[model samples]
Target chain A: MTFFGLFLLFFKIGVFTFGGGYAMIPLFFDELVTGRGLLTQPEFANLLSLAQMTPGPVGMNAATYAGFRQLGVWGAVAGTLGVMAPSLTLVLLVGIFMNRFQTNTYVRAVLDGIRPGTIGLVAAAVIFFAESSILRAPLQSLWTGEGKFGISLFGAAAFCFTFMVSKYLKWNILWIFLVTGSVGAALGYWGLI
Target chain B: MKQFQRLWPLCWEFGKISAVTVGGGVAMIPLIEEAFVDKRKFLSEEEMLDVVAVTQSVPGIIAVNMAVLTGYRAAGIAGAFAAAAGAAVPPFAAIVLVAAFFAGLGGNRAVDGMFLGVRSAVTALIFLAAIKLYRQTIKTKFSFLVAVTAFVLLGIFRVDAVSVILGAGVVGVVWMLLCRRKQKESGGGQ
Candidate 1:
């Protein structure tokens, strides 16, 4: 796609995105992974992890990574700008009309509806990740040499560990990434899964 | 001129927060609160909460929205752009470098395995985010139902998310209006 197309695509995603970056994952799956075929399922999984790994909003990180993968540095620039545009415009509008609409029933009602739906969108994202990152997609490949067992025991351990720590300790998320990523790297280096 | 003085510091504060923050928008909030409310005394704790609520409600990355609102509160529109740029640029540059490294490392076996672990952790984080939002937003029976239906539709049925969100918006408005009407009628009867 052209740079303008990249920008427009992200702008659309930005405008439509509700709740947060995680909630936008399904749209990304549909538009980029499934529809445009910009990246394979595995690559998309890598993008999600990378987006989480790196600093920035997952939405922006995904846009930048996708753009770079597609068309180099300029693509990244276009993608970032595209994603930011809607927020720039809308935040300004919200700031301008903050008092007028703060108590408006219609706006509040729409958001109330959206709040619950966002939960669903995020849960859907979890399933999407399960398919690509855990299940390794295209289930038929499971019986063939193409798809090794997608769910690793170590990965599950890490998930459970992080979930518990996050729930109870409320540690800064960066520490979780640092510790888990280090352990993961050490395991991989040793070829220990 | 006075605005420029406040603008630079506001930019610098958020820039620092953005630089260190990871795992996406919501994670930066506490740091934002620490800087704006505690260190700078630019806003009260209550105002910070309002900013968080508004930013969360808006259709953007909450980090960016928070920057825009906080910046505006501190130093008007110019400060808003300054803070947004400060918040955005550091991560942009950092991710660009990371993208380069990842592109170069695509075939490395160790990297692949490491990412496998990272992806799992990321999945866990996503689940945590969902639970956090669910607790904060899902207060009523209907809200819970909408959450479940949306999850089923999107996850199982593979329905488009945009449609689900909009449909939920309609559901929310109608449900709210009906509840209000019933309350009004009950009060009139009394």
Candidate 2:
């Protein structure tokens, strides 16, 4: 029953939350906390942190964690498969259908509609994710550091600069990632951050 | 010509991509962009974004579709498979490794931190890509209405995105039919 529940929950998440992971995320929490009543507020917040700390997409990580939380090892497998199943199935099905529909004007318009929504979803996700890290800057400054903002200003600065370079200069993003990572590590070691 | 020869590099690239680029299609973007945009420069950013819009609206791994489109653009069907293979291989290997060493990896500090950065960036990449796509798709009032409707339905009502998409699709098809019918009726009178 637990495994079934986890599978169904994520299956629904995978199928419905179009605009991809970012758009699905706020809804992920809402479903986990409000719909399922599975996790506490603090725990939900912690999973957000954990999701960020995983290699895969946030939605996949969350499903994995939620699965683990619900059913241990088997639950994790069920959840991961469940989350992926929707996309795999939907995408493949759409792939087949789209091959025929590609040149259809109406199909183009429907997709055109979907494209912007994806951007909206991504925008919402960025805002939500950056909120804890960037939006809380003022609060952190007031509570944690009087003089300093307690935000990862350096991290943000590095992220923007590297983004610009990669965007315009066509610089190798991997190299920027390497340098910024090294700088971040150095800052951590030196107790500057 | 050397058309057939390009298939070799295409195979190796897609094969490698297929194996390694795990966590689904989105994860494949940066790597694809790295190869296509930075390395080959076959398609400009706008073209790639158009591809993405088409990829998402249609279905499949954006990465796989990208590989297919890109490979097809560069070489042919053979190129598509090669690109696909390159994209898929790593994740499959890592899945096995993860199965074996996941416990150790779970608690490691460095691994944890690396994941943290990767996650943050992946999330950022999705948003940034979306931002890029949005400007392209919203051309007129009807298109804008469809986007707004989709967002409200998904975000507010918490409607299933798939259903919303399908519903929009049906509405679009129906509207076109009705328009056609009315036009035919008017022309008969004329």
Candidate 3:
């Protein structure tokens, strides 16, 4: 049941959520934390921590973890395969064929048109986050004096510092990430953002 | 005319997109559009974008959804299987092998450096693709109004993208109806 459950959860998520893996985070939280009872609230944090430490996307990592948790190694195998089964099947079929409109004008025009909309979509997301985060600077001045997550300072400062470091020092990005993660972890342990 | 020749470009592009889609893989959106919709013309822009929206509203990775949709549309189930197989094979073999043996295996500096470089490249690829797609979309729509409205509705009201898409569907249907009615009048008068 657990094995099939894992596959179904992933399939459901995979088949539905479209924009991308990031968009699936809400569902991941809902299904894992609320639906399955597979993981606890605190455990979700730990799972995120583990996810951050890995290379692949978060959705795939969660599915992989679910498999490993339920049926062990074989479970992991099933989980991974089940998660990827749709994509593997789909691309192959499309890839084998060719379309002559490969050079049509109107089709090219439409293809060209979608780009701005895509940018607008991304920009809207940025605006949504910024309204909640950046605009609160003045409000935080009057109230709690701390941003919602309280990590905003760290986020802003670290972002700037990292940019500077990368630009001038020509520093390695992985090293920056490792160093930042270690600092963040230590700060977390010390009860500071 | 020959089938095998056509397959070559798909294999190469999928492989390339797989490699470039880095970090989020979702970042491959604009690139995928360019590759399959614009460059290859394997699908129309509207079809690809619709697939993207539908795939998102459903479940799974966007890349996987795309792979499946493209496969099904192109060559029945088997083509889907083949494209999917090809798509997954590269990333799976790459990620897993890296995970199993090389990623954290023993003392490894060179491989880590290579990944770091690739990460930088993927970031570059995403930004580049985003810019290219932005050019395509903005120039074609020429409707800053609709675009802005979409952003506001989606960002501020936090309406479901699906609803907006549906509303567009309604507009399309109504427009078709109106056009038909006009055509009937024109024919009668003639």
True contacts kept of 3: 0.20
Best by lDDT: 1
- What DockQ score does model 3 reach against the true complex? 0.15
Cα lDDT, all candidates: 0.82, 0.56, 0.49
Q: Quote the positional error of residue B169 for candidate 3 in Å.
A: 6.2
lDDT of 1 by residue, B1-190 (tens): 7677888889899889877777668778889888988898888998788787788778877778888889887888898888888877877787788888888887666786777777777778888888888898889999899999999998877787778888999998999899999999999999
Please give, for residues A1-193, the per-residue lDDT of candidate 2 as tens digits: 4788788878877765554445566556557865668875434544654543334345566666777767666777676667666545555444445456677877765554555555445554554444333333433245546555444565456546555765677555355555555565565555564
Q: Tens-digit lDDT track for model 3 on B59-95?
A: 3566666666665554555545555555554454344
Q: Candidate 1: where are CA atoms >4 Å away?
A: A138-151, A168-175, A178-193, B44-46, B184-190
CAPRI accuracy category, model 1: medium
Name the best candidate (by DockQ).
Answer: 1
Task: Please compute the TM-score of chain B alone for each predicted structure, in the order given.
Answer: 0.90, 0.56, 0.48
Identify the runs in model 2 with alpha carbons over 4 angstroms from their true place. A17-73, A87-110, A137-152, A171-177, A180-182, A185-193, B1-15, B22-55, B58-124, B145-190
DockQ of each: 0.61, 0.17, 0.15
Local error of candidate 3 at B9, Å?
Answer: 15
Model 1 TM-score, all chains together: 0.89
